[model samples]
Target: MASLSLPQVDFRAAAAEGAADARLREAVRNNTLRKQEGREARWTELPDAQALRELAARIKQHTLENLDYYLRQLVDAVRRNGGVVHFAADAEQARQIVLEIAQQTGCRRIIKSKSMATEEIELTPHLERAGLDVVETDLGEFIIQVSHDRPSHLVAPIIHKDRRSIARVFSEYFHAPYNDDPPALTQQARLFLRDKFRRSEMGITGGNFLVAQTGQVCVVENEGNARQSLTTPRVLVSLVGIEKLVPRMSDLAVMVKLLARSSTGQIMTVYTNIFGSPRQNGERDGPQEFHLILLDNGRSQILGDPEYREVLRCIRCGACLNVCPVFRSIGGHAYNSVYPGPIGALLSPLMFGLERYKDLPQATSLCGACGEACPVKIDIPRLLISLRRDMVNRRLSGKLERLIYRLWAWGLQSRFLYRVIGALQRWDLRRRADADGWIARLPKLAAGWTAQRDMPAAARRSFHNIWKDRH
Candidate 1:
């Protein structure tokens, strides 16, 4: 198999061109709105939604505060259950550990469930580099894998692609008959991946929640593909973020209730599999070996930061993505990270670097919809603002922006300067206004704002001036 290039982070280019496609915009808009409606309908049906949310948040906060205790307990529990646990401080170590496991097991072909953790580590490329064929079993993930594209949404990876686009991709890649029917497309993928599953020596997946009390990993998915990936193979490898741990099995109830409803708006996902360990003595079907890797990959740093620790409380429900106006307009690709949307804007910068992902914080409209929609009640807008402040404090912002802000602050501090500036703005507006009283073009720094939009000219007279005269 040929090696495929994974997506790179180029927010500037993606925002400029990748998001300009009308079809892509329409598809994202339509799909996200549908999910939002479904979420609203299902969310309203719950009697104590707010209470559940608060409970979930508190549970997460408690777990995070004592993460070390829970993680050690979790490791001991997994070992007692005859499962192996590995801790990776970064992505390189995580990938190397998985590779070592595969080589030791002599596993060649691998089947992977939908795992953002794996994506974060670029696992597929690493495995493929070692001459292993790794297949993504989820339908959405499969589409993205075959098309050589990154996921545009968390729950629905290929939400940006319409049926026609998928059909085209299938026809071109698989040489299958040209059909836009949903079931047909699904069947085609099923038939293609069945052989891979049967031949796969190992199955890789991401855990939704790690139950520390039972040492069990809970995976939630709408499709049975994850089940097949974990069970059909001889070895099962689960890669989970360190933040996914919950205190007890009973706590899963609150998370499970909020997760499904907030994500796809289902009463419950099709499969919520919990695996404590490999196949037991009496078990008929299960992996012979179970390996759980707890990945830190910048999460520990984020956890240490008081202001951003709330970000780890995310359930990966994608509700925030569905409600974010910026996400709706530009889609996930614009963020250019494994995670996208409001949560992505917060997580990517913290996980990666503030300097590299500076634009992510600026992408929001500060509408607070993401915070309102979050099942765990993370204040996403507050985090975005905090990140912006950090940028300014670090002097990461450009000189021009600093100068402009300083000038505006100075003008506001002096009443005479404020009035003079206002008068100058009115004079400029009068000079620049066209017949329609619109500024079609702006000079220098402000030109970018008017590139795709018209700026309304200022009012003919200031309200203060008119009020003063009338009095």
Candidate 2:
């Protein structure tokens, strides 16, 4: 490992570039989002948007409902198309499979693209530990990789670091005498990576969607690196999340239309490749062998939970992060998960289990901006509420916290219980009341809430209490 200037999480952050790209997009999003909001404001005006959303929702719902059947069908189709499929239950198993493949093919160098599934598993460090030279090819991913920084955004991993910081990274890493300039820094990486791509023995990528009907694997990338990686390498491997399968190629048309547009406001990326097997009979350039690793690191457990199945439809467009005020302020690092922002808050717990990040679901203001920004129209806020319910049901919340909710529920059960507590609090609250309707200081347990903002002096009188007396 290189002793770099960036945060420890930065390395992990860039591996999932879209989550990182969020940093760069946040400001620009403010101006552009207004137009998107205007366009979406007239959502009723564009009935087609709702119609497309319904179609997408139904398509994903159907796939999730019959997950087993679709996964098996996808595997069979890929195998029949002359591609190999490997199933990994967790990160260790996935890494081992990749390691074994790398060792088998005797690969020394590899080029990779932006893949959050790979990051959630923390596969890159494992590969590096296995002593393989892994290179990130996406511009943002590459910058973060070289600088040893985490991604602050979902779509642009190196968004937090502007050209000046990136130029310093290149200068330090490559000894390329240069100043802060985007084109100069990009060209430096370009020239440096060209040789690495040409010499790499294997290339690893993530799939956008797997079509079971035609056995086609779709990859959407902005740079030409994905094509170069697949074509230049002797062996090509795609590490696809199990949930990425689409029942048929026709379904891909709809998703493709919405994917890049929603993510970057572009109609489509610079490259969109869909090829099942390697180069057919006499094709010029493509991998000699193709392998697909279907990973299930807790996706199956989530599928059975009725409240959250629709979350699987996320295309990783990052529109939610762009619109989220919280994401804009503290950024992705605070969440401390590979998937950050609105989607991360919901998906991380379900995939990794809720106990570790129980506080994350509550990290929202219940703004619903995420749901509004979503391209596939994932009801993120609804899913977030479901997660909160799960947390309560599991009793994972702290004892004091649980006690408060229980007390509130009990109080709501009857008017008498509420009045008694209200009277006691009103009398006690007056001693500490400030003209501005705030109690600046509070008890120990309540400090967390008041530490950040002023808490209204326990409302002088309960609304219902006053209303009942006047009425």
Candidate 3:
């Protein structure tokens, strides 16, 4: 099989275009703010929310440290429970593993719940290429699939789209009557998917947490579609990242509390399903064959790196994305990766390589909002800084940027040069400033920063100059 091409994202270009879409901006802004507010309200009501977050972080840290042991225990537990497990080293291997299973089982129609792992591997396209019909059951994912679009948010895939847009998509594609109301659209989608669920021969899902002790895969979702997908099909396949393992079943409470509240601001999701193995004798409804594919896909490399291992602690809550200014402005598609936002900025480059995803690390302002919003307390801004440092050390940054930074560092080290540059900057700013002391446009290298917004002129005198005079 040919290698999958990495998404070529011109972040500057995509962001410029995305910023122009008022409708998309409005939807993203409204949804993100609402989720943030809801999360804050619910988080505050919980006594010792900070302590819970800390505990969750500690548990994740401990699990990651002993990941190999936990993974072995999980695999053994799964086998003991009558479920088969497969290890995939990369996306291609993962795709092949699933394809082989589908071909062996003669599965034509497959139902999939919302799974970022499946998205990460680009499994649906691979399965479709082999002549299988795939349907996404999540309401948001279903809308995105029908519209031939990618998910714009982690939890809410269609966060960039409004109800009116969805209604149009339904009318255009499904030939359904136009209705913009939420209930009517939901009902229409539910009716359409119910048939697919019943007919699907296989089901694919992503596990939120893999329990080592009980060998169970936990999936949390607001919709019941995941439950249906897992139980309705004859064959079930779960593709989960290696980092998703937890030490035991008891740890789920801490993660559950963090995940739901952090992602959707719900005290508890509508459904939290834990599946161990296929249906045994006398058991009904579950799949006949249960397959768990533990995907590495560069995650093991991350696990080895102490600086970035905390990234694995992320519960996919999307709280960081909600608080991210860059994500809010550009949206997920502009990141040009399956994962987006602050977490994506860090993970994409780490998994895909810094050279291929060089621009991703620079996509942030290092505002630290992502770190603050993160339930597991992954220091996203710090990770971003580390990626940038790696880029600089590898000389991946452009010559001009490296040169400018070298000069900046040199200037900062020398008091005389710093004062000279500061004075020159103030003089230049004063020259360009209008009567209102606002520079609407800047020249050359600085123009991009000023293009979108005005830059305030520098003060008439430097703080150093004023301090020197007063002394």
Model 2: per-residue lDDT, tens digit, 33-87? 6535543554434447767777877787788888889888888888888998899
Point out where model 1 deviates above 4 Å.
1-10, 469-471
Q: Between the candidate structures 2 and 3, which one is better when assessed by lDDT? A: 3
User: Could you give me the TM-score of model 3 versus the true structure?
Assistant: 0.96
lDDT of 1 at 109: 88
lDDT of 1: 0.90
- Count clashes in each candidate, considering only residues at least 3 apart in sequence or on different chains: 0, 17, 0
Residue-pair clashes, model 3: 0
lDDT of 3 by residue, 1-471 (tens): 113355676778888788888877877888899999989988999999999999999999999999989999999999999999999999999999999999999998999999999988888877887888999999999999889898978898899888899999998877878889999999899899999998989999999999999999999998899999899999999999999999887898789988989988899999999997999999868999999999999888999999999999988899998988888887788888788889989888888887877888987789998999899999999889999999999999999999999999999999999999999999999899999999999999999879789999999988888898876
Tens-place lDDT per residue, model 1, 1-471, is 111134456777787665688888888888889889989999899998899899999999899999999999899999999999999888888999999999999998899999889888889878898898899999999999889888988899998889998999999988877999999998899999999988889999999999999999999998898999889999999999999999998898889989989999888999999996999999998899999999999999989988889899999999999988788788888887888999999988899888778999987789999999999999999999999999999999999999999899999999789888999998897789898899988998789878989888998888878988987
Clashes of 2: 17
| lDDT agreement of model 2 with the native | 0.77
Of the two candidates 1 and 2, the one with more favorable lDDT, higher being better, is: 1
